[model samples]
Target: MKTTSITHRLADLGGAKWDLHTAARDRSDRGEDIVEMTIGEPDVALPEPLARAATRAIEAGRTQYSNGRGENGLRDALAESYSARRGRCFERDNVLCFPGTQTALYAVMQGVAETGDEVLVGDPLYATYEGVIRATGADMVPVPLKAEHGFRMQADDIAQRITERTRAILLNTPHNPTGAILRPAELEAIAEIALKHDLWLISDEVYEDLVFEGNSFTSPLTLEQIADRTIAVSSISKSHAAPGMRSGWAIGPRGFMDALLPVSETMLFGNQPFIADVTEEAVRAGSTVADGMRQRFAKRAQYLADRLEAETVLRVHRPEAGMFALVDVSPLGMDCDAFAWALLENAGVAVMPGSSFGAHLQNWVRLALTVEDAAMTKAVDRISEFARSVAVAAQ
Candidate 1:
């Protein structure tokens, strides 16, 4: 049997991107003491209101096939949420629901790009981004996100790389791996370029709810001039600590929705009604647990940065939002891969090498901030001690 090139390009459905983390899990399953910081998943349980909503929907016989786009309630709820937040007049017609942010992004890529087309994405982006773009037969053009800019994509850099083949710009805010949120001015400049080039702006905003106290999350869709060309995808996975629910949606121009409805149906007709009901509750009532997560993750990030700066050769780049922080390990004279693997093998600490995200992160290691307070304290202590030992060995 012949297979499509997508399978080869997907790299075993993107498992290759997480090989280190997978190996750590394998060891942990064998009863090793690995403090797994390799994944950015929320540690909290699903909010009670959402859980109750799903159960009630199931008990009330809501387990039927939904429409091609999505259930009206979830769509309407999402529309309302976006409208209120962005100050834009969105309707159900502008919403298309998928199981999660991953699927929504895949569909958007398929809609805006294809073979011979180039989609401009920031380097060291979310790990699965490479697969989704490649799966659409589009080349992902890496726009270097400079560490000096706190890893945020600069509009000038984006403009410099705009070739005629460029068809779309894929953006992740409160970005994965780095957790740097784009400022409104930067977003406005980028949006203007997208308009000037007549390219689609695909914004991945899944972590919008987890922003730290002093920072705010901005979306290109909020720029009124770019709304017609901008498509934003999000979910309750992080906000409600409900990743398993797999309820997500995209809000974009009506024309894009009109064209993408078939693509959405072709993949899967629609999501489960029970899940839709749960999602509707999540979007409408909002997540009470997100505030708590904001406090914990932000606290851990500061603690990680302060401890590393005070006690070791390592340096931490604290995140404005999201569940991960990057630690600079170049001072230890080891690449991030060597540093991460050695930390796991000798110190029982499992963190992701920054290179796994992309080349720009080659000198850094990213660690999840979702562990309990005591567990996180112990992990940081181990990392500090490991960093000192590595530095001494180099000395």
Candidate 2:
């Protein structure tokens, strides 16, 4: 008799981070102390305004299903807020809200590319991107982000990789793992490449609101030439510390959004109205909360980088924004996966191996600055000791 089988795309995908997270959780359940620095979740509390707004909506019975494109009021607020940030006017029709940024990204990929198409992505990218691209049946073409250049995706590199089959370029500013923020000129250059190749630009700006003092956040929508082809995906998850709310949206050309609506409908039907209402309030009034969290994360990133540099053999790549730093642990004479596993087993600390992001990052590890100061300090101390032990063993 024949047996049911999983699709090749799904079978080929790997969730290394989730696997490590589960391992860490299991160890903790067994009474071992585990300092989780594997995921990019914020340690901050959700802003009171968001919570209050959500409660008000729920009490007022605003729990019905919203339009697939989102409620008009929330879309209007997002349009106004994002227009101000991107320097481009966006109408309500330009937005499609999803349960989360991950869903938004997947829907956009499905709407833009089909099977046999190619999408260029930066190496050392967020791990889920590969799965999403594969799920859409589009081949993910990796454009190497050189560490020598701080892992910033160069426009020339993108231009060099484009083929007739290339449908889009996926970007994450203030990127995960590396936390390298793209400069305005770099964005402009990339925009030009997208225009030249007639390719779509999917810019994930979830970390836009978390930028540090010196760096500025520029949206791909700002480029008038590529505005029509660019889809800006963002959420209040990282910035407002509201991941559980699952509020996120994609802003693009109305035509593209029209095409994406069915995908969102099929995948999610629609987001909860209460969540959209809460998101609207968060967008309008939660800047102070977001700003305070960003400042704290920036400080935490610096503190962790400083500690790693002084205490451990790892070379830290201090991020300009976002909640993670990439540390080169090759000095310990082991690959990143080995180092991470050993650290988790021996030191009770869990960090993501850089190879989980991209093959080129095999000798690196990503440390999330989401833990409290005391825990972060203690985790670093354990990492330092582990590094020293490995070095001594090597000698």
Candidate 3:
């Protein structure tokens, strides 16, 4: 009578990362007035057309299970979208639909790496990345994303870390937790390393639509040389503000997609047809909410950075894209965990400690940029005052 080793592998991944956020929740449950800024839940609501599409599908009796690779129409729409953006032709066979990016990444990890292998991902990544890699019985190798570089994962850093055991390089751009987008040249460099090492390049591009005016996103799938080695996963969760729909897909070489088909079937043979129809319509119509999120996120992030810099000892690493703002709390004379807890208890604001992402981020803390101006201003006001007290006491 025994559970499996994989259970032990992933048992440590889920609960503890959200300790501060959990504590914040408990305090708020006790009738406390708490301003929660830890989770990256999109503040925006789903657009009318998308919602109508879902309703229409349900009325049309489109609630059955989809095919193993998803409905042909949705896959075709996804292939067309990526083909237009990447300048590389894609077909339905190259796209495999999943419930969301989390599931897509999990299947891709199982397809690309396995027991005793390694997958290189940027440190201070989205917290669930390690869990997915570990679930496949592979080790997630960390390549530090330095603050000096805006926390963008460096090509050289990734290159230096690749070993013979390395089976793939997992990329998230525009990255989560830090909102650092990789440049086209940097992606080309990474493709070269993958080519030289014969490794898979698995990209998480869920934040692709959120790039601001001055920034752009490039996927490794664009490189002709590594065409067969690249796999990308994304969802309408952020782009369309459609997280509850749980619709996403993976695009990769035909062979990889072919190999992953049975795995997708065994796990969850199909997505909800009604949701797939809605996702297809979304892909065809394109993202309507991304621009609004980009504008609001940029504006709020800049205001937070400016206020922190002018009024307190904390510094924000300005982001190029995506929704979260990374603030360096090292000047508070305490680590991010200590600073975050005290800020929550004393100021009624809750943000995640850097340790939730990785050790490299321990001196920093992350707050969601989805809050409105008034609430953001209030949170920063409390943060500034709390910071001043710490600074004065340290002096």
**lDDT winner:** 3
Q: Candidate 1 — worst ten consecutive residues by lDDT sum? A: 8-17
Candidate 1 structure quality by residue, lDDT tens digits, 1-395: 88888877776555777888999999999999889899878888987778888889999999999998999998999889889999889999999999999999989889999889999999988988888899988888999999999999999999999999999999999799898999999998999899899999999999999999999988888898988899999998999999998888899999999999999999998889999999998888888999999999999999999999999978899899999999989888889999999999989999999888887999999999999999899998899898888788878
> lDDT by residue for model 2 over 1-395, one digit each (tens)?
65333267766566545677789989989999999998888677787878888899999999987777898899999999978887889989999998889989989999878888999999999988988898888899999998888899999899888999999999999798788888889999998888888899999999988888888877788889887899989899988899998889999999999987888888888889999899898888755566776777788788877877887677888888888888899888889889989999999999888878888799999888888888888998898888888888888
Provide the clash count, candidate 3.
0
* TM-scores, each model vs. reference: 0.98, 0.96, 0.98
Instruction: Spell out the clash pairs found in candidate 2.
Output: none
Summarize candidate 3's per-residue lDDT along 187-300 as a digit string, tens digits.
Answer: 888888999999999999999999978988888888899999999999999999999888999998999999999999999988899999999999999988889899999999
Comparing 2 with 3 on lDDT, the higher-scoring candidate is 3
lDDT of each: 0.91, 0.87, 0.92
